[model samples]
Target chain A: MAKFSGVWATFEYLDEMSHAVEKIREKGKKPTVLSPCPRHEIDHALGEPQTRLPFISLFAGMLGCLTGYSFTAWTASDWVLPVSGKPIVAIPPFTIIGFELTILFTALFTLAGMVLLGVIDTLRHPLPPAVKKYTRFQRDRFGVVVDCDPAQTQDFEEIFKSYGAEEVHIENN
Target chain B: MSGTTFTYGKINDDMLRMLERPHPSYFLLLLGFLTALGLGVLSLAVQVNVGIGYSGINHPIAWGVYITNFVFWIGIGHAGTLISAVFYLTRAPWRTAIYRAAEAMTVFAVMTAGLFPLLHTGRPWLAYWLIPYPNQRMLWVNFKSPLAWDVFAVSTYMTVSILFFMIGLIPDIAILRDEAIRKGQKLRAMIFTPLSLFWRGTNYQWMHYMRAYLIYAAIATPLVFSVHSIVSWDFAMSSIPGWHTTIFAPYFVAGAIFSGLAMVMTVLIPVRVVFGLEDYITDHVVQSVCRVIIFTSIIVGYAYATEFFIGWYSGSPFEKAIFYFRPFGLMEEWTLTGEQSIGFPQIAFFLMVFCNVIAPIPLWRWKIRNNLVAVWIICGLINVGMWFERFNIVGSSLQREFLPAAWGSYWPTVVEFGITVGSFGFFFTLFSLFVKALPPMAIMELKEAAHPPMKKEAHG
Candidate 1:
């Protein structure tokens, strides 16, 4: 892994944080933004790609519906036991199980997708030095950590300060 | 929005402090519940050893307090999903503060409810027979049976609710991890880190997280409605007089939401006081919840009247006899040997009316709805009324059948009563532990609701 040095800046306001992200991106640096809550404006500014979770859940739910219905029908037919004189492959009642499993599988797959696509993204990228240095980003403060050469640290700090950053920390690792 | 004075930092700190600092009273209350839970476990062990006969269920009333408790708890499970999923989809901002605990209640109530069928089955060891997996003997579960439907419904409901609850917890757990690292609590940080899944609040992660949460919420809404409806069908599918009504599905769903909301209040009232969460879970939330209670109570009241009307309108002598016996209990002239002229069923009918319908009428007034004590008392009463409502529906109808010779009444044995109390103990113990372990509020969602990001404003 190529070790990149970075400077992280904390801003009290979302606007200031977004302005700082725009500035760093203008300099051809990828800035990692840490926020207390999700912001639509920040996502637009960062140009974050849309996730595939919805499509994944849709396919998973359909499979679940199939699995649920077929499981009941196949098992009943395998046994060849008629219940209360009803047909072995009862579709109407089996639909309830199918419906429940559809939701269950959809939810399970969505969580799995979230872990695979969302959380893993964070794990794949190194933790921002700022997150380790200043804990406020997890609570109230909005922050941006920009990866850069050690020689460019001062320039990034100045860009951050001009955008109303309350504090700046440089980490070279 | 008018009442929200919290900043993101303040909300995070307030919730985190509760998890970090345990109150003396919390342990005291938990100890009381744990002791009750221990007694309940002892009762269950005795019942298992002695056989299902140790319960109040007898020949005619094969489904007694155990089934009643099952339906009651499952019904209570409904409100949590209603608040968390249904309200979330409807964009009800007030739910942001209360939904976490409500979701927890749903998951726990379902767990508690899931136990009853196995407990009622005499041969609980054969509970796996309920599953329809392929086997060597080629025995499959009865797909047409409502009891089998319940296994699928309750299990799926539990599965979906737990997933929804855990997904919602991730962001808050990440916040806890960050706080733990800051506070030098290495052990807590180590525990929270992996659970948080390395959430860094990046927009990419939020994008996926938001969409997944919306999908879960969408599915959970219908799942909650279905679980309770299936529970009601367990009675309605039968040919027995009171259980044969077609209105059972909607009636049970409404009653379940009503009771579940009441349980949320019963639990949250004490929780807010103990945790000092008055700011987040305010009187507005209480009033909003009470309004829902009143609406459902009316539906429940209508169902009650409609059930009697249907019984009369159907003109079946058996239906009329059961309805009449429910309230008036076989007039003295027609009393059979071993049958009381008027019994506990009669008393249960009136009590159900008073608690489920008549008692909540006071909630229409702002004074009663907003008053914490009054809200708590009424919710407690509704919880009681709903349980009796299930009891009356299950026990009374079973006690009298088409053949008068087969009719018999049921009164729960000591073991059955102990187990019922113990289920409550188990529920509260899980809830009490949850409050202490995790952030009871959705800290991130609350901040989003309270102070949403401005659309047009930009940096100067």
Candidate 2:
């Protein structure tokens, strides 16, 4: 089945949570921190690299531009209702189509990328039940959930408390 | 959030409270708009059942009030994107409190605007013919046409706007979802869970989510300019004297932002008062918006002067005649012949000039612009003016074309008037429901902008 054993700590203050995060990482554990809002401090402490979402946006945008230009050009040429000396497939007007589609595709694909990547990440690490119970973590509290053995639960709890955690739940599944 | 201090929990509670059952007056207000919407629906049904002739549109004046309304609403939608996307890219702090409502306005305004073209067509069923899909006839929509371009631009603008708006809402909805779970509201929680996309505020989600938001904003920023520019081209591409001007794109865009900011202020002022959110939607934001309004107003005024200059300077009698007819319709001839007669186009022209150019000039004064009541009135005037501005451009130009024999005047029929009122009702009704249904402010973004709760030791 699924494992729910971990140490879930909540801090009222951002600094205290960042301190707890640093201590947990020093102890050779990667702690999953949650907050009501994303913090630059927490991000800096976690030291994760930038996401690849921009690449996806760029790729989608280029695809949209190419498709937009080609589709318009091809359609106009195929259905030759020759206007008064205007070019069969004009560049200036077609550019408008390309420009609009670029934005549309870029926006749609970027959102898709965020959702897909987030789903993959969620699958890799299901949320601990104890962490889920503290709904206040999405409101006023900042949380750090780290997995450890049943024996080390006490040690982790003390470390959390030492860093001034408002509450700590030790789960031994 | 700049001058105000709010704890994360307080922010959540304050915003959620807006979604709670409002005062009795709120329902009455909703009822009034719903009634107006009903009237609009009746009118539209009548028009559809009878014919488009119920509207005051004929040859030379076929693009009457409906096209004017289409341009006006589309213009109104631009400021929302500007506030949400452009302000976001620039990292303007004032946008935090105001952008959510503005985004909602954009979506709803576009919704209201989309109805006009369908209503104008008299056969909304065949509106799908505007699309470029292949059919049995092997016929495709003309790619060279600006109307075809409008079909793509508007739909794309609407889609991008909704997505950008929704993406911004996800984190806030997640908070609301968690709140529901905490309160034991199972149904509310279940509803919000999917709407939130099961957001958990994990670092992984934030990382990707933040980057995606930036990318969307970046893409949407240019879109803000292009969509309205494309709309302006709908008229500019035509050979109409007043409509065919190089300055129309920028001129329309500036007016769009001007009128849009006025609208945002118009709605936000009352909303902030009603919800007791003055601290969040502060005076500073209003002043910033007023400054933008002043800047755009000047550009709009400049465009007006430029148009007159171009009319006279181009040495084209057609352009000159249309310009002269706009402000002083039949005045030159009427005065020469000693006849006292004035046209409706003259009234529209003066109203446009007064509302768009002269009315906002008071905002240049810090004392006047700072007064919310004053700001609201100016915005209301600008809205009236902007509509007339469109009318003057579309109606006056078409009213007196190249051939005096082809000259005719157009006034909106009662049915056309009902439909116009209905579009407003539709917009306001959607906005009323939106504020109660969703967080009118960007809760997470507000929290991000605020100083986080920190330990005394951490402060050092």
Candidate 3:
């Protein structure tokens, strides 16, 4: 028999996604989140390293900066548009282009960061049968779970409940 | 907390008596409003007859009194949102008693402000000319015109501000409606019944109400800063010499808020005294306002210096001339032109800086900022100073532009002056009505402020 357990807490504090990571790391179980914009401080309480994606914004901004300056430089001097007598290496004017690029890329990176870090649909993962009955894991409760096997299942329910799991169940495969 | 609880030092028996009985002292307010409205009507007709020309506008100094009044009202509008969103976000407890009046101030000031640009227009009827969509006239509004952006900014600012005021009012309206119905007060119950929208303070309603309120608050805080910055841009973005400054957007905004907060003090001091809401408003609230005024004043001072510094740095002689001519320039001093000090826009600049910046520092003391008399006086000075800033910026910059030959002074005719007074009245009239219409405090939020939301970890 497989063991089942769930974690529940309000959206900000015991956030499902943050909980899922802890379960998988600590006890080989998956955790989940049921809300948006969980508090930053709660990441520590949940024991999950901040791993999602705001850094992509910085990376994209830097990349956009280089691309913007390069394009501006090339168009003004390298490509040789002979129709007008515009200055080559116009750094002041290109600064405006750089500023615009920085804003555009930073915004795009923030959107990309959210998609990559958090799974939108919680049910798609292929975990062991133990997590199937733990749908309440995303509710207003917080629990830490450990997967137990029949060989180690001596009073498994009591042990899990003592550690603050609201409910524990066995899944038959 | 003292007996007066919040606003005044103590809640005296007389204050309770004043609140209970409808004394003529309180009723005299209706007379003030009527006189204000009557003056406004008569002056408006005269203003229309004489045209904007009689108000002392010329080609170069075209923006004069009307723009000054616009910036002033917009600045007056700032304190409402500041108290509502920023104070709410930071969880300032005292915001409960003061936020409603501030929001009312915001709505009225915006209404007053929206009129000035129309007044500034040569053809106020063609005010609709700012609209972008092609009409029978078939001419598209120039997207690049700063004025066109203003039409969008001011209208949107008014819409959002009204919504924020209304959203904040809903629960209080329900409370008042209930009180009126129970007491058998006909007029109030009739006025507020439909507006209550069937609120019963259920958990579900509170949840959704809170969510919507937070969203509006979030939107308003940014809008407060952005709206005036857009107004300042109408001046700063132009290639005109004194008008072109990068620092202007922020400077204008800070000054706007500073003056706005000062106006709040001015209005509230009288309100607290007259209504005897001593327990509702307090010395600490006054002190907090003083602190904000000080902070914004310093920034306003910093902006003044930076403008001169940037002009020097840019090394554009035209820019340099514009800056120099502003205060110290002989041409700016009306004595040189043989006009009275009234026509000297430079006088407006000096007074603006003096009132908005220099005059408020003594409030750093526990005595001055907390003293009702001192605070009221300072608030009045700040009002004067802020009005000067707009005059200095809008009028002087136009007066001392690149084309020296085109420059002339503006002098507001009696009609213009009377209308300006009327706008102030209009602003206050709306504010007074709002005071009576709803509880001035966010009673729901007060619960959380008095007691922090219980963390689930407490149970854990």
Candidate 4:
């Protein structure tokens, strides 16, 4: 089992949360921030790199386009039903299916990418017990969970309280 | 501080309260919708058992009310994707308040629209034949046909719309899961937890979620244009006089958006009132949508005029005959009484023009557009008008074809009407359930848009 301990602090304001996150990081501890909505200031403070979901969508879209066109062409040729005296391999009309499937697959891949990546990222750093204590983190509250040594918990708690934390809790896992 | 009157906690409380508190009116309305849906199922059953002959469609006018309703519902679905996906891609902030319900409308409307083709097939049980799978018969789908394209387009649109809707719901569902956990609703928490994909609002999750949403938005934009264009081609690809025009694509698209915005208004107005979401949905949002309605209505009106002008200018007797017969049916002679003399097609044509054109003109005034009651009534008119427009196009054109001998009038049987009513009931029922279950407004998005509070001055 993954073992860790931390101090979770709930902030009423984004600026306060941002300050607390910076303070935790300055002390060389990894801090996780949670808020009801995505905040630019908090994100910048966390310094997480951009996700590769767009590239995944693009690759999936290209595959979808190829599959759409090739499947239609292969199927048409397999059962060579000449339609209305037109060519057996109709590229023009087949493009519609290709276009639609490209969008469909891109959307599907994007959803898959987001969910898989999100779930993996979350599982890697399990929810800290401190964060769990305040359900408002998923609602209105902005929170920072600092992974710190048990001996330093008091110092972190003072830092969070000075930064206008509404509540602070300690949890070990 | 965000300029919003609501705090994040307040939003959670307000939204979750809707689920916990069930007003008597909700049950009563649900009962009404369910009854309507039951009646629709009964009508469909009658058609299935007694044969599609129970419908008014026959001979030349083979596509009647069913096709009309199909196009109408499909058109209604367009505004949702347009407002949600297109507006999001363009970074329009106003979409935040309205897109959740609009996206839901897209899903339900498409669901309702998908049923018509099956219902019209006379043998709905074999509807699977429309799909192209490797079969022992060694036959392949005719990819050249617009009908085939329609199958692909509609299915793709439905899948993508549903995915987009579901993805947007994840964050809100996580909030609900948290709320349920706090309130000791274990069953609700159990259900919502997995659905939320264990969202913890971490920076990594937000990064991926935002990127995926942008990609989905980008892909969905073209889909809004293509699906209806393909649907229009189901008629335009034919050799039929009125349906064969090149203008059909743009005309259909504009009309689709026009009617779709109207439907969004129709659905949102009552929802805004019932849920008391006026502060978020706002009169400004309603007016902004009205502006879109006005623009699309003009395009539709122009398409209408161009169709008539082109018919008269083309000098083709067949085209002229169809165009003329639409507003003034079989002008050669009428021995019937005064009321009967004005035929069904003529009445449908006039109503289409009046509802689609004349009724929406009032939206030009800020006074009329700002009033919820007026907007609702106007949107209802546009909805009726758009249905008649489809009816006129499908019924009027086919009723009087190339040869006069083949010309015959058509009207929908009671079964067709019941099924149409049921489609509305079905749409409303799904919407009602959605409102009660999910946050009608996007809670996170609204919270994001709100103005943050100003920081207090630093103490000496």
Identify the candidate with maximal TM-score: 2
Q: What digit string (tens of lDDT, one per residue) describes model 3 on residues B37-154?
A: 6787688877777776667777767677888899889988998889998888787767766787788888889999998888778668878777644356444543344665566567
Model no. 1, DockQ: 0.61
**Tens-digit lDDT track of model 3 for A77-118:** 533433245455666545544544554454444434433333
* Ranking according to DockQ, highest score first: 2, 4, 1, 3
Candidate 1 per-residue lDDT over residues B1-460, each given as its tens digit: 4435567777787888788768687789899999989888999999999999878788978898899999999999999999998999999888988999999999999999989999999889989888876688878788778989898888889888888898899889989888889989899889988998777787667888899888988999888889888988998888999899889999999999999999999999998987788888888898899999999999999999998898899989988888888878767724546555447687789899999999999999999987999999999999999999999998899888988889887788899888998999999999999998998889888877656433346433
Tens digits of per-residue lDDT for model 1 on A96-169? Answer: 98998898889888888887886556655565544665667668888787777799999999999998888888
Docking band of candidate 3: incorrect
Better of 2 and 3 by TM-score: 2
Better of 2 and 4 by TM-score: 2
lDDT of 3 at B455: 27
Worst 10 residues of 1 chain A by lDDT: A124-133
Q: How close is each model in CA RMSD to the real structure? A: 2.7, 2.0, 11.3, 2.5
Computed on alpha carbons, the lDDT of every model, listed in order, comes to: 0.86, 0.89, 0.64, 0.86
Q: If you assessed candidate 1 against the hidden native complex, which CAPRI class would it receive?
A: medium
Model 2 lDDT tens row, B338-451:
664566678788999999899999999999988999999999999999999998988888888889999887778999899999999999999999999999999898888777
Q: What docking grade applies to model 4?
A: medium
Best by DockQ: 2
| Residue B69 alpha-carbon offset, candidate 4, angstroms | 0.9
Query: Model 3: DockQ against the native?
Result: 0.03
How should the candidates be ordered by TM-score, best one leading?
Answer: 2, 4, 1, 3
